[model samples]
Target chain A: MRAVGEGAGGPKSLPLILARELAANLATPMFLIDAGGTLVYYNDAAEGLIGRSFGEQGEISAGQFGEMLQLTEPDGTPVRRRDTPAGVAFFQRCPSHRVLQATGYDGVRRTVEVTAYPLFGTTDEMHGVVTVFWETGG
Target chain B: MDVGVWGCRGSLAAPGPETIRYGGNTSCLDVVLSSGHHLILDAGTGMRPLGVMLDNAGVDEVHVLLTHLHLDHLQGLGFFRPLFRPGVAVHVWGPASPVQSLSDRIAIYLSPPLFPVRLADIPSDVTFHDEPLEAVAIGSATVRAAKVTHQGPTVGYRIEEGGASLVYLPDHEPSLGVTLANHPADWTSGYELACDADVLLHDAQYGDDEYPRHVGWGHSCVEHVVDFAAKANVGNVVLFHHDPYHDDDDLEHLLVQARARWTSAPERVRLACEGMTITLDANGVAFGAQAARA
Candidate 1:
């Protein structure tokens, strides 16, 4: 994995640095989810946002991760990883962004506007997705 | 045209730093018409800035339209500078619901318990016009109102002139029931309310997932906004009523999503931000940050 990320930066992983750089300055909750919508990377805001420690949750898949977040659409529909705004953005080839209510572990629901962008590798193959989640209001 | 939110709070003011960026002022929108006519959507706290703007411009005659008498919509009339100008004539329009006159409705808020002054103390020559949703002409433009979805009685306006139209329906919910089934083919659904208008400033206070929790809250979801924009065939659809929690970066992301989903021929969809000005002509639409001094 480190070799895949290293170019000329010695032993440092380029992809990890890229992810860190992307998530560093965001004031809102941001994360990088795999094509399966699994939890791969999360920012500091994500910790405070969903009320759960990211890495300690074990290797959770997208669907399982959504369950932990208690995610559901306004119409009482399930939010599968493939159907998440981020998921939809990737497969559907259209950006999916909207203000959504996400229920945390404590059952507290916060209004979030989520934006998802699809990422591709050098071979023009799909890699994963970068999702930025913003808590509504200042 | 230039649109400044001024007030974004609903029902009443939620004054605090948390509500400041998007504004805690109620639902006042200052729309500068192409003909330079100053149109005030509501007198919410947001109107204070507009009042100051008009004061500096020495603007006298102004047209003020009230959607309803919800406190947030009229709270700032007390602070509006133009209302006290000696030679200024302010025309107020509101729905002729079962409530008292428009002036009487606004007076309740200005009275002793709410504030020290009375509505009559204002020096401007104020005239109130009450009627059902009907067309009223201003200069060469036509401003018409239509009943909308809300708790108390409410109405939305459509302003058209010089082959350009701008629809203001600040307090509305996107649903297929009461409001949609009643209107004609042109103004029935959110799409109809916006059909071919140069700009449709519709209420998109929540996201699709937030709709269930906020059903009947008199606001639409971003998805519905995109849906309406696509179906209405409008030039551009601006998502108004920013959720108090969303910041500049969050709004930018939402605009990206709206643009991605928009499939109109000459597509236009964006989030409404303070100081954002939109210019429309026969060719297309253009957006820019309004000069701060303007």
Candidate 2:
């Protein structure tokens, strides 16, 4: 690897690299995934919302992230991996947007809106997805 | 693995008395693995001559990895000897376009009005791959293709084997409108394909003085290329894709300027010329023992 990341090995995919870069620059919270369903990255802005630094949780599965954040629907139903914006974008290879409730590691629950889009290279090869989210309300 | 530079000129083939020393064929490179498998980098005018030599050498199977479909890079496809030969397996790999299929795009040149022979008319068993399933293994080399900063859909290649890696971005401009330093390694275009490779053959088509006029033309000036190489921290940097307008003397001047500005390691930088073959192994990069010196 040319340059090391906090929790994951350096991304070799072009789209991943560009995604990671764009994620780092923005003030909004962002999450990244690989094609095989690995949660490869989260920006520093995500620390407060996700309740952990990327350094502490490098690469994890979507289910693991769900468990860590304890996500649920606004009506108090637990969210499945396929129902989240990231999951829909991954499985459907399309954009996803939704409002959901999440219980942070610090025991604070917040309503959040997530927008996700699949990352594809110039040849239409799927690299992963980039998910951007923000706290909508308490 | 050995990297042979068949042609290093960019944009167009400028073969004349003034450009004689550097030779005037556009972007073509030849990589021969220890197992005798050949990987051709581009199908520029230089590939025509390289094809002749490969045919004479009796090499049957070859993989041609094209960066893009620019005319300078695709001009030599019809003239390639192996594409015309019988019983030869010619696998052509290129960047996939969202709109057109690889076979259809390449046929624009290989077919009727442009050339007498259609792509299907070629005798060799030709296989086209617009998409490489991530990293594909060829002989002893693992090749990964990723899109880079270029005019049309272009991709840089990273070939790794035996702990050595060679990155080819013969037509790249990582510094278009923004300062590359403001971004992380992952943010910069072409950085992922080039990071930590033993050899990085990148585009150095213009000097700093000539760059402002050609912004977004998709070729790097000397300053940007050298800066990018230093930032990537590769073992060696071979300035490739020489501008056709720059004569041999001008290229030397650029080399001098590059070395002068390369604060990290001046000795690690050099220019790409026709017939310069680089060998990479566990021992690291060995450059230009067979180079055609200017």
Candidate 3:
């Protein structure tokens, strides 16, 4: 598990309020990433799915996390870090939904459906991205 | 028929001074028929206040029509006061799931460590129903559900009574099917729901510029809603499920843009705001001033 410092980009960002609300309440596994794709926050449910706790490992960059977990298509073809739902949602300023297989930090494999949407500030500026995912198969 | 907008914000509740005017609750509507039967729509955070009102009024029975099992749509169920009252009866109806029963799907959140109490522990005689394929009657009104394009299995609804009808389709993305080319037949189902409706409450979650980016997000822009309302010949089109970031002023501007783009009877278009009310009957549709809090 990893925890970003209190004054880190996520908690200090304008969209943190919404992200925190989602992190606290949503039952689905959710991850919040900064505009630059640094892993900012992952809720309890997300930690369960990722096989690690945010409190232990600290913040992980998108590239590092992708490389470590090795997310891939259902058939095991590698998926580019920039093409992940969170990546596309952040860069394209849109919402994206896809199903992919991921190897967790504990080496457990799961097929998950992920929906990622860009988070915007009050000024309509893109601030970050929120991804909600759930394991699909046993 | 009378309709009250208990909550209109989309995605999540945004309660604060900035959202006070339009409202910050998620998505709940209180619809009452001529016979005084209550029809609740969605179950967003707005349901909290609505539950208070219903409990105060001593209403004992509620028929909840959920469009889907999305969190924002069902979050208020746990807090709805009536559901905890021993004598109150609550019937929840929603789209059927192939993998799990509707009650089971809702119970996933209603029970265990997530909440302090379980659905079975609630004193209300709560019942969940998988809506039938055809229109069903509740009191004098007939309710019909049709599949709509969304991320999951979602449905739009139409309620008709006393020769007047109202349609509610709060989250929809028509372009998804049109773009896919594999589901063209589903495109016209939205128009069918709105056909000749006295009030058509449709999703207008984004503006023109914001829509292109959210193409597959299962929400519509104001322009698309207005165009559909015109083609369906709806008596009134209420732009609903406002984006959480849009303030009242932004909604007012969107209303202006919607009216300008409406091909016929621009005055018939309106924006859905929390606390707003509309009455529908054989004679015509009438809008009410914002209700004062009790």
Candidate 4:
């Protein structure tokens, strides 16, 4: 049977399409979210950190992404998603970075460094945001 | 608004005795708003005739919304009468390229050994819009262009005028990345444009039996197109971009298959044929005359 969710159908603008392509090429973990805050794509490297492939998650809302991966400070202090790099980049339309602790879909907790930036066109048109992160936990 | 198909033949211009019934031109559509605004959807060979009609009507300005720079889609630009007439304002809009600007990409074909005339050699005052993510107003009509899945940089347009919406996705392949069945409306490519549209001219270039061989070709088969229309819940589905290889009988067969699939289609499902016009008003969609033979 054909696998679902790798590159599921969605209204992807050119920038998002190119971002997804770029993400797939990078060995680092990456995730692509749409203007609507829907998690549209994630790279194969991201699958390890995510504990599941993008084909498995399909498309999830931003809130859903938060619920799927609850994050906290290194000391286990609860943190709001809006404080994360992805959240700041999405809401502020700028670049952001952070080191946080999180538990992925597989219930494994890990500390990771995350960097995110809004995807923009040459004309400064906002397509969405691309989030990349490094995993410290296996 | 009145939507007319000047050329529905897809891929290549198939002018022959077999294609006479459906007309043998590539993908050009003529849209006339009630306010006398003229919009040509593509610059296929059918555009030549549409340009002549505009010239006969003495229209000094026109907008051509292109889906992409594919040869069949751009085949009629050189012959379009308005582009050759001085004092004519020709506005062309299409998808943006990664390496070059839209005008430069178009110029690649308009100039050189491929064509005798250069894009600059045209007499009309031509303007090219590289990428159009923002909606633009042409008269009272609002035109929105969205990127769609195809072989290259391509987009589908949604034209909303006077409470009626007509979406033109002449060369789309929404089934490329994802399966069409039970997919969320928002997830399907070109869904937003076709959602509740009064008339949708969607790509239905292949039959189901032939789709497997042409998966990445960026054209939709009858079954897939019907599935997309159902998901979009459009009012009427006008099967567009007929394969140049398919003759009238083949198209008729495809239509029959489409009807079978869309049994509960709200208004109806019809094939886009050359010279076929569809009108939209407060009363709803009304079929206009066509050059089709009995």
Candidate 5:
């Protein structure tokens, strides 16, 4: 988890600040992945859903996130990076939603419905992507 | 105030010839105020010896402050001889979960199936109190608890008596707070608890090379501990909670490496060894004879 005023490697951008503020007050599971695809922050509610806090695990790279979450389609096929909600939202620069199966770090698997959207700066440049999700069931 | 290290090893008791120099018992400390008040920290296997000593000394009343209900920390309570003495009063204090009282939380391990006797079956008069988040007075000492970054709802303690203060955070992960986006204020609470303390006993359970694999394991590497100690400006920093795999020689090497990182008074950094006693008073912090052996 990067500090609120800092990004993965430098001072925080405007969109990063917005993402941090949005994640701070969120009660539902929410996480922010920077433009570099590094997980910058995950809220407390998100920690409960993931079975581990971002603080404890430290920053999760995009590849690590894919491997750890083990996101899969309803048909048991692996979700490609471009097809994943966060990937679509960041790369495609649009809001995306999907119902997928995710495995937490503790090995608990849950069917989750997730909504992802890109956070853009004042000049319309994408800074990061925010993902809000909840467990659909066991 | 005087602090005694009964056990400093983490995870499990590692009693053997190789571990004898540093001691193998898990996480127990004895803090005695100049006013004769005794406070015990974590009832790990080391507490058995402490209990025997206290019992033999005819000390009737004792207060135990537990950081959490981890098995290694609670395992020694069953063997603590003082609890078997009739009419002796033992007060236990610890963090309570939202759904369970501290007494009930401890009873889960102290009861049958897991253990031979129930907490209620102990001969001594025992009482459990949910420790407050704010500072509370226990005899002549005042202690405050702050939530730390750990796997569970673990808390670090700061004990102050007279003009001396000691901070104990034997299981902590400073890396957890680096991002500070989740709980920004919590990132500073650990530092605040140890700020200018006479002695800060912190977890140094891994070496720099061994930390990547054990990240988020609720323990700190020696480098992190040294960095935190220097940031807090503690008078003395004792590296406690030695990993089970680190033997006496390994710890000596780690201590040397840890001291080299301390730009401040390098002499202020030390390792916590079993039987070592540290006394803090107006005169300043003084190490007992055991420290000389180390």
Candidate 6:
């Protein structure tokens, strides 16, 4: 589609596009969740971490995500989705990551620190959040 | 690539008469480049002796790099006299912690149940920098860090200067199934961290037979060390993190077995000892007194 001269020629939408590229380039696992705590956007690292594509599945509940990652405590007890850091962060509207370890397998026991923060809209309304994690518990 | 191992041990500080032969201190290494900049890796119990050496030598500002927050790497920090003295600034660098920064990690090691003195109580001007693993520019040397196969969020260092590179992977487990299955390309195949350096100081806490039983214990066998060095094409491989039960004679036997691999394809390999110093030239290759310094 051909665009008008001013709209096509000007540096329109450059900053927005650059910001989106920068977010995609992050090395750590990053996933965005909606106000209802449903998975929305997951970067490449987040995909590798979960061993599957959160984007392909679309909306993933906090409980389902925790089960997929085999989330556990330092003592190796299964982490309840309700009590999971992501759930808590979502409900409490804050950032949190608890009990991390390095492990292999999707839905198998591994050490990792999980975190969640509330996303906000421009009008100060709740929009979505991002969760990230890494290996721990040596 | 000019590399040296000042101190290497595991678990706790093994300072005693029995350990005197191997210098019973913990982890520490002094890497010097042709530029005269010194980078001290880990401040384990070995730092006590290192501090004395540097203080007597009139080193004003020494740079310390830490791999993790384990106590063994930090126990000797208080004993390092330079921290208690004024005008001697110790610039410390470590991996970024999820809970706290590098300075906060050091503070946790000091004071109360951990130790008597607080890190803040230390008189020296100390600056802690927590950054990602990469080629970091310090004083006159370029220090690089590679995340290694360890239990926690740990990393191995590759300190280079004057063209010489020393690879330090003190606490790595070669057969980490989890790390391999997850980041197969990085950890499993061989050591991604210690490849093709002038000197590779690696964890060799177990013998060949003992490694299987200690799987997932976060340690390596002598065989793993030899294999990794050969695979990486490292110049000189130094067996580090020796088990306390294995005395110098036992280590020598292990060295014999390790050196035999080189018979078919010669590789410079040896066991690290206390007070061992390997001087490198402008080329970043070790020269003069190739073996452990006595």
Write one digit per residue (lDDT tens) for candidate 2, span B1-294: 998888899999999998887789998998999888999999999999888988988889999999999989999888899889999999999988878988899999998898899998899999999746368999999999878777888899999989999999998888865576554565578886788888999999999899999988999988888778877878888998999889999999999999998976888889888888899998878877453322
Model 3 lDDT tens row, A64-131: 87787788999999998878898788677789998999988888999999999987642354557789
For all predicted structures, in order, the TM-scores are: 0.61, 0.78, 0.66, 0.82, 0.68, 0.64
Query: Whose DockQ is higher: candidate 1's or candidate 2's?
Result: 2
Residue-level lDDT tens digits of model 4 in B1-294: 998889998989999988887888999988889888888999998988887888877899899999999998998999898889899999998887657888888888988899999988899999988545667888889899887878877889999888999999999888875568765565567877678898889999999999999988999999888899888888889998989889999999999999998878533899887878899888888887765421
Residue-level lDDT for A21 in candidate 2:
62
List of chain B TM-scores, one per candidate: 0.86, 0.96, 0.95, 0.96, 0.94, 0.88
Which 10 residues in a row give candidate 1 chain B its minimum summed lDDT? B178-187
Candidate 4 lDDT tens digits, A28-130: 9999887777788898999998899888788888768876788888888877878888899877888999888888888989999999998765445677788
Q: List the global CA lDDT of all models.
A: 0.66, 0.85, 0.80, 0.83, 0.81, 0.66
lDDT of 6 by residue, B118-137 (tens): 88888899998763344778
Q: List DockQ, one per candidate, in order.
A: 0.01, 0.30, 0.01, 0.24, 0.03, 0.04
Error of 3 at B244 (Å): 0.5
Per-residue lDDT of A18 in model 1: 41
Task: Give the Cα error of residue B211 in candidate 6, in Å.
Answer: 1.4
| Per-residue lDDT over B153-250 for candidate 1, one digit per residue giving the tens place of the 0 to 100 score | 67778877667788877777645332332322332333444678888887777766677798767777776677666566677787776665565455
Worst 10 residues of 1 chain A by lDDT: A1-10
Error of 4 at B130 (Å): 4.0
Candidate 5, CAPRI quality class derived from DockQ: incorrect
Off by over 4 Å in 5: A1-138, B177-186, B290-294
On TM-score, the stronger of 4 and 5 is: 4
In the range A1-138, model 2's lDDT, one tens digit per residue, is 111222335544656765776787789999988777778888989988988888797778766887777778888898888878998998888999988898777788989999999887655667888999999885
What lDDT does model 4 reach? 0.83
Q: Pick the candidate with the highest DockQ.
A: 2
Question: Going through the candidates in order, what is the number of backbone clashes in each?
Answer: 11, 0, 8, 1, 1, 11
Q: Compare the candidates by lDDT and give the number of the best one.
A: 2
Candidate 4 docking category?
acceptable
